[model samples]
Target: MFEKLKDLKTYEAGKPIELVVREFGIEPKDIIKLASNENPYGPPPKAIEKVKNLASEMHRYPDDSFFELKEGLSSKFNISASNIIIGAGSDQILEFAVHAISPKKVLMAGITFAMYEIYSKQVGAQILKTESVTHNLEEFYEIYKEQKPEIIFLCVPNNPLGECVDAKEVFDFIEKIDENTLVVVDGAYQEFAAHKDKNKEIKPEDILKYKNVLYTGTFSKAYGLGGMRVGYGIANEYIIENLHKLRPPFNITTLSLAAAIEALKDEEFVKNSIIKNFEEMEKYVSFAKENNLKYIDSYTNFIVLYIKNSTQIAENLLKKGIIVRNMASYGFEALRITIGTPEQNDKLLNTLKGMIS
Candidate 1:
């Protein structure tokens, strides 16, 4: 009965604070979770208030059109509402793309966002991966010429590893591909990448000009709305129209829509979160250096440190009321730690010091 799902491996998210509480008998208040690349500062103040105000509207369904949220996104990106498609999260958008395209062959990085491979497998498509751990356009081109994959996924400022490819390099690579091949640029960490390096920025407007390119973004990271589950894809009107067909009615909740709409209006909150993220990231970098540990120079809200015994260290940290992502599942002996607030970062660093030493 579950034919297509037989080989599929479920995506394992970062250990949640609640899970740590249940498993280790640690109080939620005492646990500092650096596992998920979530905004440790919490959601935007305005978004929080909006969600509270929207609490009474839970009985009603969200607008299927999602016109208001789309409009806010339209104005922000200078793109028409027709060019966008909202999803439960950017990962949902990835699913929509995979289903809509129904590709025979899919291409992605050797190590990238797991959803790319997971969704492709669901559709029974053959998956092709580049040899390099990070995005390499030349290697991608070589594979593209030989395999002619139907869809390509580029995760900028890629997760787990934290390295980014130049936007121009990405565009150049996309330009060489035929119009029939779809290229999905997963920019879940785009805001952080842009803030860290101007060369890494890939604007929605620019992406829209390419008919085959779909740029996906999420409010879960820099926008501090991880709990809201709001994300979107920007492309030409034709691609958005097709993706809409696969979208379920009211895929997101009323409160989530309200939270995202309010979150979009508070640019200052997003800005400050990004600013603090990098500032706190510097501390992690310094800590890595002090311990003589090698780490990827991250452009996202998290950093990945190459450790000799990451799994043991991560477990030890959990016992001390700190939770970090051990990248063992991704085939790396490293830890992907979300950059947290100053106090939170300090606590994590101190805890890590005792473990590593």
Candidate 2:
């Protein structure tokens, strides 16, 4: 076994409703899982219909070329289909980048997504991170000058922390970096960020000018297609060509491809999900303020609250069939709660209020 594999801890995902049922004996209908940043409304109706309609076609393999899906993404983003590479999920695209670069060192924000570090470690790369929990581009640039890392990961509208950096600032910072270093811009939450602030939007077409940069996006967030497992990366032709070399044929299911394609056409569904997300999110902000709790202003579907006894609170919530993420693994006394539906949020808020008071 590789030395890194011996010590590597498996990535811990949020507790699924099935697992909660098995462990806590909670009834499925009674549970409101706000642990994963899933769309509370679920996948788009069009996607649901597509998946249902394609149920009989499960025996057929998905188009390995992904021509239609790529075409849809290209039209939506105003980029060439040649510039796109589809993945099982954006996480798989991250894996391809790590393998392709075979980097000696990887750089990322101190407390962003965990997969970046996990994937890098699998290839024995030394992981580097910014000192600040939130993204600080100045620190990143300084470190880049000193370290000359082979790969740098910028997770815009950063996960867990729920903060985003301005796109102009990011572009300016990238302009200073050496071309030998590949910059991976993970915008898994970009749809939400762009809806919240126009300046936070980093267009694939705008970034495609740089051969060294790759922008990754997923339909799983705002599109409400988390189960579909569809994601893609947009870059200059050269980058996409190389990444495709590592992709497995028919990596996505036939149903997933169709669902994503249909989800792309349902603009109203995505818009409503983002709008409802922010509307529900405001309630969280208000609850935090009314209770005098500190929180990061969220650009994404989830919010992190810096609270006392977060572990205890999380445990209590879990007992009551309300699933929320405890930030103890990230070394913080906080809770990262996904914004749920109106009724679900009320249940969480009322339950939380009693515990804290």
Q: On residues 1-357, what C-alpha lDDT tens digit does candidate 1 reach at each position?
A: 998899999999888888889988988889898888999889999999988887998999999899999999999989999999999999999999999988999999999999899999988999999989889889999999999999999999798789999999999998999999999999999999999899999999999888899999999999988888999999999999999999999999999999999999999999999998999899989999999999998899999998878999988898888989898887879999989889999998988888788
Local lDDT at 144 for model 2: 90
Winning candidate number (lDDT): 2
Q: What's the number of clashes in each of the models?
A: 0, 0
Query: Which residue pairs show backbone clashes in model 1?
Result: none
Please, what are the lDDT tens digits per residue for candidate 2 over residues 1-357? 576688677888898999779888989999999998999999889889989999999999988888888898889999899999999889999999999999999999999999999999999999999999889999999889998999999999999889999999999988998888999999999999999999999998998989799999998888887888889999999999999999998999999999999999999999999999999999999999999999999999999988899999999999999999999999889999999999999999999999999
User: Model 2, residue 204: displacement in angstroms?
Assistant: 0.8
**Cα error of candidate 1 at position 212, Å:** 0.7
Off by over 4 Å in 2: none
| TM-score against truth, every candidate | 0.98, 0.99
Alpha-carbon local distance difference test for all models: 0.92, 0.92
